[model samples]
Target: MRIAILAHEQFPDGAKTALGVLRYADDEVVAVLDRDRSGHRVTDFVSDVQDAPIVAGMGDLEDDVDALLIGIAPIGGGFEESWREDVRTALERGCDVVSGLHYFLSEDEEFVELAAENGCELRDVRRPPDDLSVSEGVAADVDAEVILTVGTDCSVGKMTATMKLARDARAAGYDAEVIPTGQTGIMIEGWGIPVDRVVSDFTAGAVEEMILECGDDHDYLFVEGQGSIVHPAYSGVTCGILHGAMPDRLVLCHDAGRQAIGGYESFSLPSIPTYVDLYERLAEPVRDAPVVAGALNTAGLAEPAAREAVDEFAASLDAPATDVIRFGTDEVLETLLSSNPNR
Candidate 1:
């Protein structure tokens, strides 16, 4: 689909949803609507966000775009009333609208009528099905090698690492699927449980079901992880997802140059060896998955510094490590593809 990322009022701030669409969406992204970034190239700021021109609104949109993706994930996941006009304009232009926010446009009478009249569709990604059940731990028994992207902290690039690995693996002829474990992934991929939305008791179960379902068809399942196992506030869901996925290989995601756990000043992020060992210890009874690689988020770092960080991280692990976005996930992907699971 030819697409325009619609994050007009809120880009370059908390525009992760927009960045994700730009980074991983398979469609042709013709433009991005971010009033704050008008007259700039998206690639100038986010190297991974592609080369699309950043426009102020639909009036500046290039021709032939078929979809307008709501691309900002605000805190509390609420959709803003301010963005409605942009949505209306996209609908009038025959563009299907997809949003990752908790607000459902399909339920809005105006949006629904506009879409119906224009033969467009609205995809509210967080809309869960009524028949959902608790996870049953069935993913553990699946035939594929289950791997997950666990992070040192939230927003440290877990989903980015998972998606990059999946894209690269598919390119290398593997039937790899990154299990979208959050709302953003759900919005992008059309499947996944917002593990955070489900009741706490069912979070792991929901995660398990995603793994189990994907396990049957794919050669590898790279589960997108949530909050840190060490994060003070969001740890519960983090641990729940860990147990449910039962991965045999773990991609430890961490950002370069971060001193403390984000927003938790009292807590200092642990050393690489310490975090990796603790992750293994936590998963030992359930399964003996090793932290096979490190996916270091180097977005804030310069090229030389990022490369140096990758080398130092690789030196600390038995497996390969690299900045998946900047240098690619080749080292880690080769390690997984070449290693014999039973050996």
Candidate 2:
């Protein structure tokens, strides 16, 4: 697939969709469609995208592009009316549209007619599957080491840490697979059921099914977690992720500077140790999943301060810790190796 990402006005937030696609999808990302950023490189905004021209309109898209990826995750994950013209143009050009939003472009008659008229496809990535049911909690039956990324709060690098550790484990000669649980992860990995989009009653089962499919023979199943278990509104999805993965080892993901949960004001964050205990208690029914390491997100802090924060965080937990994004996952992988360095 030759993809042209429709990022529009939302550079980083919209380009976030492109981030996963550029990393995991087997596609030639020809350009990113953000009008104001035209002529700039995608690397200018997302340093990891290698390089793709930021184009202003469909006229600027390369002639051979096969698809237009709606490459932004907005606040509510809803379809923005403002993106209509861009998507319409893409479809009119006979490029299939792939959307990860909660809104289904396939269900919209305009998009449906456009795709049909142009022989283009409309893919809705967040649509729940038809057969999902309550979780049987059968993931523990697998022989693999199920390791999950649990976070102190949402958007605290849970998915990134999970993917990072999986990459490290593979490089170290272990067979590890990261099981994605969210829309972005699904987009990256190509087959996960979006547990959050499923009916609340079936969310856990959706996750459990994903685990059983991927957890069979891998040395480690790095389950990408969703919302915080302590988050008031999003706790249900978090609980589903926790119970479905049924992990035997856990990695706690948090940011260096998040003193409290981002949106909620009433609660101050407990100490890292306390938060670790909280996760342990929830996972106790499945296994005594120790918080094997702390994965810190020290993205904006100075390099020296980030390193200091990593050292201090490890000291606080008396366990392995690293800014997995800024730094590498060697320390965290070493901690896992100490217990079982599988080949």
Candidate 3:
């Protein structure tokens, strides 16, 4: 089968590589589209697909291919329209379409109806991998009453939230350990949680091992996945880690500030977005999965703002107090977790 992947040039290397895996398994690739010209070339990875051919425009692929993998590279306003037209054209050509990039705007009723009428299968490729068939609880959840996963990167709140939950568990008189996913030090003692250094390697097996080690003997484990794997500068291998560990509950750390209000701007939230507005956005791909609310490092050294935000966000979502905590100071962490029984 001849498959064509239409993408923007700025697409993240990890996703491109993952798509390449699909390409490697499938037949020839007809085209690879992108708006930008320079970066780590996709051809290196998709050698066989490249051997077939690549065209600069999605329109160029028309009627020449059987399947069209629409790689939705995050594009802004005008480009988004152009890309949608390209997608529609591919569908009209009777091609099967799959996409992980965010392109479905609520207002795109015309495009949506057209796509439905055309019988194109638009699938989100970046959605969680569902075929693992791995057993949950096989590697015991950490036996410590609670475990905290921390980091020094953009989404430290994810780590802090996990730690606070652990501290809260201990303040309520349960044993807990707050370990840094990186080298960040534990600010306070007591609370009964120990901080450990995260492993440097971020491959699938390595991440799985880290989770197994951290969660060993602990009842509740807080694994932090900070930053978007799709972003270039903020490269932390978060997606691979998430895929490898598959934490009991994923607390996706997001920015809750002005930018992320409605999430109409971007399909996948930015790595360090201000806040999470669309709950359905986070829930859908993970199979309508449960997610703990996580925020970025906004309330550092401040008493009320971070705590208030987390509380309000949780209240709105009715998220479990036990599962959600402010990614802030030790005092705040203690206060948040102390109220929950599931620590």
Candidate 4:
């Protein structure tokens, strides 16, 4: 399908969902709706992904789009009021409106009416399943080797690392699958329970259900991680995923040179060694998961600095490390394969 991403002011960095769709999705991205960077091309900011025009709004779109994807996943997953008009315009143009936010566009009366009138579809990707229950602690019993991506903080490349590793593993002739836990992953994979959207009591259960479904079929399950364990606001979801996954190996993800939580700047992040210790200790009771590797986000850093950061991060974690996007996933994937006894 051809599409346009509505990211408003949060393009590139803040619109992670947009980047993920641009880099990995099968659909063609015709344009990006970001008022702040109106006339700039996506190639100007990010060279690796699909190139598309950056329009100011839906009306500015020069090409016909099959869908309008809400690409910014904010802290609360709230919908922006300023975006309502653009969404309305898309619906009026008979285009599907896809959103990953906690706020459901399908439930909104105005959007709902507009969709019906234009015969358009409104997809809320973050909607949780109705049968979700508490975790049964059976995630560890699966036959597959589970390697989950845990993060030092939010948006540190957990989803990116998980997807990259899964892709490379499959390309290497291994039966691997990515068990997505977020909206962006769900959008890319076409199926997954958004763990963060699930009720707090059922978050672990939600993750467990997916693992149980895919575990026996694939040799490896690359479970995408969520919020940082140290994040005050999002730690619950992070812990739920960790305990629910009960993974055999963990890949700690972090943004290079990030000293504090992304949004909460007052609370500084713990040292890399401290984070490793915390994750291992926390996973001990559920399952003895060790930090097998590291995925560092080195965006905006020069080549030399990025390499230096990767070396330092690897030294601190005492494991293989690399920027999966800039470099390949070879180092981390090799480490995972070597560490897995079944392989």
Better of 2 and 3 by TM-score: 2
Ranking by lDDT: 4, 1, 2, 3
Q: Report lDDT (CA) for all predictions.
A: 0.82, 0.82, 0.43, 0.92
lDDT of 2 by residue, 94-121 (tens): 9998888888999999999999999999
Stretch of 10 with least lDDT, candidate 3 = 188-197
Error of 3 at 258 (Å): 5.9
RMSD of 2: 2.2
TM-score list, all predictions: 0.91, 0.93, 0.37, 0.95
lDDT of 4 by residue, 1-343 (tens): 9999999999987899999999888899999999999999999999778999999999998678899999997777888899999999999999999999999999999999999999999999899989999999999888899999999998899999998899889999999999999999988787898998888999899999999998999889999999989998999999999999989999999999899997789999999999999999999999899999999999969999999999999999999999999988887899897756533
TM-score, prediction 2: 0.93
Which candidate should be chosen as best, given TM-score against the real structure?
4
Error of 1 at 146 (Å): 0.8
Against the true structure, candidate 4 has what lDDT?
Answer: 0.92
Predicted candidate 3 versus true structure: per-residue lDDT over 179-233, tens digit per residue: 3332111112111111111232333344445456656655455554444444443
Global CA lDDT computed for model 2? 0.82
The best candidate by lDDT is 4
